[model samples]
Target: MSGSDSDRESAKNEAIRIIATDTASVLKFYGALEPSPGEEPLPPAEIVTPEWALFRWVQVQLLMSLDVFFRYRGRVPEASALTHCWYEKIEHDFLDAEYLVLGVLEGAFATFERKLQAYWQMLRPDGVLMS
Candidate 1:
């Protein structure tokens, strides 16, 4: 191949190498969260941490959909269609029929950081102790 063609091929190979290295580093970071026997297990889901982050980011889109629907609440057709789409995505993706609704609520139990802190503090008279 000509020198120019060889240079382009070399650059493409370097880009692939960089991407593979980055992916390996990310996988290593997530591997740290893996639990051992006798340890409290992580949540069992098909989604990984990165995937979950991406999935939860959809909440922003969900919020926008809800906002538009509320803004045009008097217009039944448009509002209904938006609401339907919102429910469809949430119910299908986040809270599917296979998973109990209570499981979702249980996940939300950790949403209140301060409340969790208070609850843990109650367990220790000194208010702070290493587990």
Candidate 2:
């Protein structure tokens, strides 16, 4: 491959890495909010909210698309499209419920919530236009 093609491939791989890592971190943080079956018990009130559940569900979808993207690289247009769509959903949900979600999380999981927020901000398009 030419230098330009190699650079493009590298950027694609970097994007995949960032998405996969951030998704995993968010998933782990969400998992931490839940109580294990037996050893660790949590109060009913501390359980994940419906919004969190929805967020997690969408994150899982994004992860699945990321997996397909990794397997096929840029060859599978559908996988890339799905990944972008799912990511947009996540961003929209985060922006819309930022306060509600963070308020609940800040009480007990402040550090994790902050980290998740940072990740969310990092994913934003900012000045760049996304295709």
Best by TM-score: 2
How close is each model in CA RMSD to the real structure?
A: 20.8, 15.2
Which regions of candidate 2 fall more than 4 Å away from where they truly are? 1-51, 77-131
Compose the digit string of candidate 2's lDDT tens values, residues 5-124: 678668655654554356555545455566556756533434444345444344434434554454455454555476877767657545534542443333322233443444334443
Candidate 1: list runs displaced more than 4 Å.
Answer: 1-45, 48-53, 74-131
The residue-level lDDT of candidate 1 at 104 comes to 25
- Indicate the TM-score of model 1: 0.20
Q: Please write out the lDDT profile of model 1 over residues 1-131, one tens digit for every residue.
A: 23575675575445433322343433443445567888987554344442354222332223233333443442435454667676575455343212212222233222233422332232223323232
Q: For model 2, what is the C-alpha lDDT against the true structure?
A: 0.46
List the pairs of residues colliding in candidate 2.
none
lDDT of 1 at 12: 45
